[model samples]
Target chain A: MTVKFNNRDPVYVQVIQHFKEQIAKGYFEPGQEIPSRRELANQLKINPNTAQRAYKEMGEQGLIFTEGNMPSCITKDEAVLKSVREELIIEAVDLFLGSIKSIDVPLSEVLEIVKKKHDAESGEAEGSK
Target chain B: MIEVKNVEKKYGKKRVLKGLSFTAEKGEITCLIGINGVGKTTIMKAIMALTPINSGEILIDGEKIRKESFEKITFIPDTITMLPQMKICEAFAFMADFYKNWDSKRADELLQFFKLDSTERIANLSKGNMAKVNMILGLALNVDYLLMDEPFSGIDIFSREQIAEVFTSHLIEDRGVIITTHEISDIEHLIDRAVLIDNGEVLKEFSVEEVREKEGKSVVDVMREVYRG
Candidate 1:
């Protein structure tokens, strides 16, 4: 629930991004209840209007839903959830590729290093578990 | 809405407010930002009718501020105004007697929220506790608009953060808040709009989110461009 927000980006946009990341990471399950805009504002130490705006945007994007008097909940649609995960993966890979492109390394060599790093990190995670 | 239109103020030969204008809507926090002596406190005082303005008009909702406006608005000065010998509960009794809008229940709630001991004397309070007590005096009222002067200034970072938390909590409700501060880094995210002042005039008045959305800039970035450009 804690987010160290950057000052430059619109706070509502950052909030939406945070929600998307949580959904993609499986931390927010499908159809899970979400905090009310006011509660979110208090918890995040952000303006209530910004939190409201973020919720409105999320509703429009089908990332969350509200029904008569009930608290808003994460979208239960599988396609939307799948797309959110794909979107985050693509974004992270694009950023990584952009950084690697500046170094002019061959794709084959870069993929080999990526595979090795990924395996080592996953192995550590497994050992910890 | 609290409308301050083309307001001007003077002190002896010096002009403090030069046709400053801004509107603070209910349910939003409008910040008056400037360094020391740029007339931020002067504007708050003018709105409260604590001082005379040379020209222009100040309005609450639509009508001009009057004796009854005190019921609709409250001002929290930077310092605690209670007697040093008074206990925290005694100060609450004083406020309850003086202001019809004072809510003793909410005052008690704020005392618990701040973790302030009701039996503690004002003279024994640390600077941080005094600031919190000052805030409670203003906030424990059934008023629509709240004006605060330098609530975070000259306090510890932890105290500053605690005060900042008040802005986001239900304690504020939908009250129109006009807060003056020379320092904004701590509560920048909590305000709806910022009115940047320099030399008694508004340099820029903008919605904080709109600036970030449209110009890709933070409040500090705009301040740098306006103040140093």
Candidate 2:
């Protein structure tokens, strides 16, 4: 997963965002084994305890599962994965709604903006990195 | 009662704590808030006698936090790991044997609240489960003060809600609690007083009501500037 800290929100929210990024990037499939807390902790250099916390949170949200001592795994059910992805997309939309909320943009207008921006950004996307 | 006046700490050449002073009274839940790596934990450790400060005097209820006052205060930091090899059913008993303040009744109640199978080995418990154990021990103790650093950082949001409630009713108002955490939103409504720290210094102290009226900002937002980059 891609974990990054954002001071604007709580750390656990950042963890959830990281999980969403992993899902988007195809590194974590619906039914694949997630990294163990210790491994992730070593990778991120945070306390193993904090990484364990992220895993525990993910499990509680039904995004992943672990049977007691079993290694924690992402829910591999395709339907479940699609649904979680949809939830993430909705969360992102709501986060960015401020841009459109005040303008009272209809669905068609929003789609037009999106379509226009996509083509324009695609031409310059690689340069952003 | 705790006091630190004009205290300073330096890690080699880098100054962590500048001149700082703050007094935490009995029966008060004083929250300490700051950004990361600001030495909030170091101050707590100093209060707990876990770490010695280079220059500072930490007094508890008029007496300095020396060998004698250590037992009067209880500290539960984040990630208090019990020996993974042991079971809670056994370890609870072991803790009872050591800490005379331990109350078996409260511990049992907490075990039920957490729905923990006491027979399950500590290694088998989830992070949330382990945090529950730590929470139980802190509540079971009969002490004048409890200090916790980042207690909510390791638990799920749902569990954090439960723990916050537990903190409200179980926490003794006649005693005291000093909590250091980055999750200010989690405890903003719970804590009565706020202690804002930065670079190991006390920047401001405001009552929950005082902060709202005087600063026109939540304690979290007010303190964010103190630890601002």
Candidate 3:
């Protein structure tokens, strides 16, 4: 999976957001083993301390957990998984609404455009499959 | 910790460092940033004691710099330090001979990581490959503090990316690093603190995260404010 990070925010926060997005998209399934902190740091080209901080924050958020010395895994709790998914959806909708509000277009027109875009994307996905 | 207190240096009649002072704490990457000819390298040279200071003092871990301290700190100059005629393996042997802390296994690992063949002559390698060799030489030594002077200078984008990747890996995790670079974008996210230098003086020094949190400014933004203003 490819994760593109914005330079404006703290890197660990962006790393957590990337993992959240992956989890919400079902790319990282529940109870799947995630990369170790060092591995993640090496892959992302961030400081190892930043990777450790990201993992710690993710653990605190109940998004991932570690057992003994084993590597961390995605949360297996259905409630946590559902909340993570819903939170991402809400965040996307809020961002979309905020951006659209700055323009002159009405909400209904923006919704229509989004519907067309979504349908076209899903159609392309089905064709590829 | 490496601390420089009111350090001053001069060449002939021209002063290079004018009462410059800063601290690089243990387990942190502190970047020394400024435009070219702003004495960024001068400060690094003074810290390494490669160049004599006119006044003031530099301390590594609360002790004055001495021959023994040289073993504790490794300085990687921007240009290649090894003889141009030496092959990569010969350079490695040179380092192994001089430094008691040199780890040949680590050197071999870094050589493989940088995709450098030990048989290649240093003079024949590309600019990027030469820089990689320079980095590997400095990193193979087990030292508490690593001072890199413009490690990113005059390198290609791909080489810079490879060197930047080293910051994240276990290769540099425990040491206190003080790196001087005019190009901050290459290491914007990796640095813990930035010491902004202008005219041989530290204009400002602050933790990067604190600046991001309090002022919503990246190191580049802060540089613009300090330099442009």
Candidate 4:
């Protein structure tokens, strides 16, 4: 899959997001070996140097890990997974809080609305299954 | 790799670029960004042999480049380089003859993607379309690198997005692209690395994430703070 540069946010961040999306989609399983720098760069149509930066950032973020000559792989660390999940939840919570605050809506009303929507969506999914 | 070792350029009394040195590895897109009139385009010109450097060493793939190597790289100056009256097809044919690697199929596809009427004269098209056409040609030429100066300038929002996407697909792996522009917001996400230029000198160079991680700022907000100071 070729990586497209849109000149909107920055290239390295987009690469990081791409990797996360892949992981979330199970395109890359936990502990799965990641592609080498050159291979990933070629596949994404990006510079190897940029690809290197993405890998480095992923390692620092605990999304991926490297050990000796065994190539980098997705991290299956429970603690790291918990942190990422929390981060995603925090972002969603912030947005949800912001919208409710802007309209001066009460927390009770917002939670009730969220619960209703969640139930409806899960109900639809169960019916489909 | 493209290296600029102690390169210098000046116009009359004003020095545009001051002994700058940086390397753009193959398959990377390095964006030269700065406030208005910071010599971003000057660097691109020096790389493409359009303008002479006052003093410095310019190397491409570790070798000094010359006129013969022009085919190896393509340059699109911020100011549209092609003649205004040149028809779209005429410009395409001209480049095809100039560079042997020019892909006619790709060129045809890009022209149509931009929705440029080849039969309609270039002068007749709006200024925005002209910029789009200029970019389409530079990108369609299969080369080791493509250097673009302000490809998004003089264009509205819709065309900018369309043109950017087209340029994105034209990039071949192992080939680098350098773009210089003042409007960093729109194209900020497209660049692999951001090179900040100021007063003819490079202030900083980092991946998009590094800037955010280290400075705790988005590129747009950081740029505003940098230039305002």
Each model's DockQ score? 0.83, 0.02, 0.67, 0.17
My TM-score estimates for the predictions, one after another, are: 0.97, 0.61, 0.95, 0.70
Tens digits of lDDT, candidate 3, A20-92: 8899899999999999988998888888888898999999999999999988999999999999889989998
Q: Which portions of model 4 miss their true places by more than 4 Å?
A: A1-129, B170-172
Instruction: List model 4 lDDT by residue over B1-229, tens digit each.
Output: 7887889998998888899877787777788888778888788888887789999999998888876677788888765666778888888888888788888888788777778788767788887888887777877877888888888887899888775664345354468888888887775554667788898898777777566656656777666666686
Interface RMSD of each: 0.8, 12.3, 1.2, 5.4
lDDT (0 to 1) per candidate: 0.94, 0.74, 0.91, 0.77
Could you tell me how far off, in angstroms, the CA of residue B209 lies in candidate 4 after the best superposition? 2.4
- The 10 consecutive residues of candidate 3 chain A with the worst lDDT sum are A1-10
lDDT of 1 by residue, B52-130 (tens): 9999999999989998999999999999999999999999999999899999999999899899999999999999999
Off by over 4 Å in 1: none
Which residue pairs in candidate 2 collide?
A30-A75, A30-A76, A31-A76, B27-B175
**Candidate 2 residue-wise lDDT, B44-108, digit = tens:** 88788786667867788887776656568888878755788898878888878878888888888
* Candidates sorted on DockQ, descending: 1, 3, 4, 2
User: Where is model 1 chain B poorest over a 10-residue stretch in terms of lDDT?
Assistant: B167-176
Runs off by more than 4 Å, candidate 3: none
- Model 2 / residue A112 / CA error / Å: 38
In model 1, what lDDT does residue B201 have? Answer: 97
Over the full model, what C-alpha lDDT does candidate 1 score relative to the true structure?
A: 0.94
Ranked by lDDT, top first = 1, 3, 4, 2
Please compute the TM-score of chain B alone for each predicted structure, in the order given: 0.98, 0.91, 0.98, 0.92
Candidate 1 residue A126 C-alpha distance from true site, Å: 3.3
Q: How far is candidate 4 from the true structure (C-alpha RMSD, Å)?
A: 6.3
